[model samples]
Target: MFTYEISPVFILMEEVVLRKMHSIIGWPEEDGDGIFCPGNNTMSNLYSVLLARFHLFPAVKTHGMSVIPRLALFTSEHSHYSIKKSAAVLGIGSENVIVIRRDERGKMISSELNSSIVAGLVPFYVSATAGTTVCGTFDPLNEIVDICEHHGLWIQNDAQWAALLLRTNQEVIHYHNRLQRAMCCSQGLLQECNQLCAEYLFQPDKHYDVSYDTGDKRIQCGRHIDVFKLAFEAQINHCLENAEYLYYKLKRTDFKLVFKGKVNKVNFFCCVFSNPATQREDVDFLIDEIACLACEL
Candidate 1:
């Protein structure tokens, strides 16, 4: 019923509220009758990665009459909490999920990840975050991908916040290994991709009748259509430029630089207002001032 354009910025740091579907959803690459929900692209990326991992492990395949596949996922301790949440929602035992250790920058240490896999954990899925909320940091995507490849694991890169991968100056040659599926909410890029790769990349299932009959991949049913529109609008409006403006302005101001990333999104270190011992009115005043300034623009 819907499709998402995948991105690779090296990405969820959002809560998604799902509404009821009016009908059975169909294949996203193709189309049919179904209720559609605007899924969070980040969540979709996470889910797809897990699904891809399922297809990688032959031993984890569905048994004779069962369709459920046992999956084990790996993520860093500093990674987003959604990884665990997704595992729980997907019926995978939370205990089966392994939290890989990370370095000082919160990037999962390659040795640990490899060790876990070599130790026969054989996690079918490994996720690396591009940007974290507490601190905007990128995990080593290429290296992790290599490790996954060596061990027959599928890797998913969360590029939700690092939407800047669309910038003209961005370089993604380092991340092009079997990354056939990705997710983005940028409309302009999706349209551009459709124009460039539409003919060769996407095709409707000729045997939709057979595949659609069983309603397989019901997990893939709720794809979102508006993600592209949102991304397009953000880029068209120079959203990243405006973010840069605020970032530079705040950095030059009395505030400190806590954590910073690309122009598309940035955060500042405001120890003064964030201190719990600080007076509430003072924090409120600062917040109000920022809000007023934002409204003026």
Candidate 2:
């Protein structure tokens, strides 16, 4: 029963940001397609699963899950729980979401994933975690992709690293104008899967190009102007530098690395550097305070 109006300006902003995202992912500026969801990555995951379901069984949109065979989805044990949540929300049932094994470094074991695709259930989707939630280890994407290709499963890469990379104001500017040609490939699929073609809002007879009216491509009636906030730019190198500084500082203090060895890339604990305001003095104080608290324990 909820209702909302989509402004022309809001539609323009969405188009700009979607194009920016495509460029960031090294896709053609005008080639790929996507929609900015009112929710976070979890919602996006839901959309991805919904798209996969609809893609494989178009009748599911009109006829429901009863029309299709029992479907199975695969994800790493270390991946976000949203995959199962998506399954449950879509009436696919959480039991159908198969959990793949992860290695010592918390990366998904591709071999285990290949072997996990059991008999009877039609494996339609696989969610690959790029940066895991706990250990922040990246899954072996190439190997996983090969397996998914072999099984003819729809692959969705859950990557949050780009958000971390674009957290700072400096890095945002660095990559701002650097546009390239590549494709998301999923955008069109998403539109095809979810579009209701409501004539009231998405009237093709309108004077302006109706393609920018992307609200129909979503499941919800009210679409928020989420792209408004991303209008500003940010940087990554400065944040990475800050992370490296904290990494060495933490090493010298009472804090022990969760995984021992040389500190190469900044680990998950250095997320504070995402804030551009974080300075060396703050990092020093944090390290000292944590060490002091540890000693008191």
Best by lDDT: 2
> TM-scores of the models, in the given order?
0.56, 0.82
- Error (Å) of candidate 2 at residue 143 is 0.8
Which one wins on TM-score? 2
Question: Per-residue lDDT for 1-297 in model 1, tens only?
Answer: 222223111001010101111011112322222111144344554444444544553333343213444556788887777777777765666776889987765678888987787454336878787765555577888888889888777677665455334322242434533221234222122232222223332344433322222112334433334324323433433544544445566666655454333432445442211122344455446656976887799
The C-alpha lDDT values of all candidates are 0.48, 0.69
Tell me the lDDT of model 2 at 212.
61
Scored by lDDT, model 2 comes in at 0.69
Range of the 10 consecutive residues with the lowest summed lDDT in candidate 2: 175-184
The C-alpha stretches of model 1 lying farther than 4 A from their native spots are: 2-37, 57-71, 167-173, 178-224, 230-237, 259-297
